[model samples]
Target: MMKFIGEAMNETMKRNFSECPPFFTPFGDTHKCISLFTPIKVSWFEARMFCESMTGNLAILDDINTYIQLLKYIEEKVCNCVNSKINKQCEDNERKLMPRFTGDAETCLSILEENFYYFSDEWCTVKLSPLCMTNKI
Candidate 1:
């Protein structure tokens, strides 16, 4: 039964990709496809695992230009004021409010719309939706 279910899921994925790829949005000139998972909230670690399951990873905005592009895309496409926290791979000096990732091993990076869409540090166990990106898609 599990094998059947897996096969069905694979078929569905193939069909869906043929119609509209999961990561259809082109992220700038980087040739990466990005998609925001908004339906369910999970911990930062769980979010990363989920993205990995989809053959992607949690978005890492390493540069200001990429950050701005993603911010604009989220604002225009997937803005949900009530649930605005999205998991991300955080680095130091990425945003004004971004905490030093090296300071706390238990903390993870996230983008919060309530915080003016700036990067913020939160416990890795905190629940948030994932912003997944993939180069192969």
Candidate 2:
């Protein structure tokens, strides 16, 4: 059956696409990881939807080092981009959420911000990142 074949192919792809250790695809192939800025505010689920709708999925922070650096970059950008107490607060909130989720969080769960990972060398090896999006939050 066509459905059966599709399912089989899906399974095959999932099996072959498995990532090793800390390396994982935070977003699918559609959306690219943005390095710039955009004040895109939405819920985590909404962010995922936005990513998918805009040709990607939610951002994923696989390690801690890159996460800390990225956090500082975002905060610095925010401090410079919009210097205000409220802006700082909002940016702080956003940074807190970035590395909150792991690759697999099927059910609603909490995250530990102490963890981090390295910079993704190539966006292609996974799926997304070329479209590094900035938050329009």
Give TM per candidate. Answer: 0.66, 0.37
Error of 2 at 47 (Å): 1.0
Weakest lDDT window of 10 consecutive positions for candidate 2: 122-131
What lDDT does candidate 2 reach at residue 133?
Answer: 40
Write the residue-wise lDDT of candidate 2 on 50-124 in tens digits: 455644444545556545655665555434645654344333333323222343444322222233323222211
Badly placed stretches (over 4 Å) of model 1 are 1-24, 80-103
The per-prediction tally of clashing pairs is 0, 24
Give the Cα lDDT of each candidate: 0.62, 0.36
**Cα lDDT for residue 74, model 2?**
50
Instruction: Give the top-scoring candidate (lDDT).
Output: 1
Model 2, position 47, has a per-residue lDDT of: 47
